[model samples]
Target: MRVTIFNYGAGNLFSIQAALRKEGAKPSVTKTGSGMKEADALILPGVGSFDQAANSLPMEEIREVIRSGKPTLGICLGLQLFFGGSEEGRAKGLSLLKGRVRRLPPSVKVPQIGWNTLNVERENELVSGLDKEPWVYYVNSYYPETDGKWVVATSDYGVRFPCLVAEKNFYGTQFHPEKSGATGRTILQNFLKAAKK
Candidate 1:
């Protein structure tokens, strides 16, 4: 299926493209709204600050995509951008999910870089074929503290935070599955399969 990886000038688009292709998906990366609107599935990937990523894109079209109820996946800053607001910036997001992003406290590393294992909290389509303690790559400081229902997985560093999230047509991961090897591929494959449904 054709999947468009959002090319909003911040994410590691080529790596995400490679990951999708590895999952047997015919994927393309673009910054245009029309390309995004016509894709069978869309992936929002980001690799920078919240405000830089937010202000650099067409927010209205993105909101419309989420509202369309088609399958969409977000990663890292892309995931953080789905929230109402982020402590990383004063600007607002698509608010597709109800929550605010906050930076991890100084107790641990600011970026929280490297491999960490995520514990599946609820049975969801995202981690369907993955192992119980899946090690995923991460490079972020801020995360969403979702309420009870939306959380699909949790990972601990200095403290536990939402790692995988799913709500209807929308899905997000705080970790980078593209960089996580086999376990990461499983997560992306699951997303591709779920989008077909």
Candidate 2:
């Protein structure tokens, strides 16, 4: 499949691209909106502050992609950007999904950077072959706070928060599937399968 990786200036594009390639996908890394028109699927990958990434994104094109119902996946900060806004910065997000990204409570480690188990709350194409609960890697200080309507999975640090979310053709993961080993690969493969449908 032709997967377009959106590089909004602060993402781990190389690793994400490499992972997609390993999954047997043709990934094109682009900072501009040029080739998005031909994408079978789009991935928004990020590893920095929410506002920085939000400000750099080509929203109109992204919205068009979403409107077309092409499968789109967001990773890490990319997941945070799916919300209305974030506490990490003043810039607003794509607002494709309802909610805001908030800083993790002070009770837990600032950035929970390890393997955490995923509590699958609902069945979706994103976690097709996983167990009821599976372990995935996460590296973030903020989590999306919503009413659990779009949350398909949750992970607990000190507080249970959204981990994997899906709304129509859009899907997001708070963890880095590219770095999460076998389970992660399965998630990506599932996403590709969903895209083909």
Candidate 3:
């Protein structure tokens, strides 16, 4: 499959590409809109503040891809950008999904960087072969706060927050699937499978 990884100046392109390669899919990294037109699937892998990432994105181009209903996956900050807006910055998000990203409660460590278990709230192809409660890697200070309808899985870091979400063809994960191990590869493979359909 031709997977296009969006590079809007804030994503971990190299690692993400490596992960995709490991999953048996070659990836093309680009910041231009032209790449999206020929892609079978889109992966937005990010690692940085929301405002900077939002500023770097080609808004109209991204919206066009979303409107087309192409399978799109967002990781880490990439996922946060799918929301209406984020508390991390004043810049608006792609707003592909109805929700807002908020800073994690002060009760827990600001940036919960480590392995955490996910509580699957619903079943979907994205987590197709994952265990009931699978461990994934995370590094973030903000999480999405949305209705249960959009949440497919959640994790507890001081509070039960949405960790995995899906709405139609769009899917997102708060953790870095590229950084996670076998479970992460499964998730990527599932996303590719979904794209084929």
Best by lDDT: 2
Tell how far residue 116 is off in model 2, in angstroms: 0.6
lDDT of 3 by residue, 1-197 (tens): 78888777744579889988876777998776567878888888866788877888787788778878988999988899888799999998998888799999999988999999999888888888887669999999999988757799999999899999988888999999888898888888888888889
- Report the C-alpha displacement of residue 38, candidate 3, in angstroms: 0.7
Candidate 2 lDDT at 62 equals 89
C-alpha positional error of residue 191 in candidate 3 after TM-score superposition, expressed in Å = 0.7
Candidate 2 at residue 190, lDDT?
90
lDDT of 1 by residue, 97-160 (tens): 8778988988998889899999998999888888757899998889887776789999997878
On a 0 to 100 scale, what is the lDDT of residue 3 in model 1? 91
Give the lDDT of residue 49 in candidate 1.
78
Q: Assess candidate 1 and give its lDDT.
A: 0.85
Question: In order, what lDDT does every prediction score?
Answer: 0.85, 0.87, 0.86
Q: In model 3, what lDDT does residue 114 have?
A: 97
Q: Which ten residues in a row have the lowest lDDT in candidate 2?
A: 5-14
TM-scores of the candidates are: 0.95, 0.95, 0.95
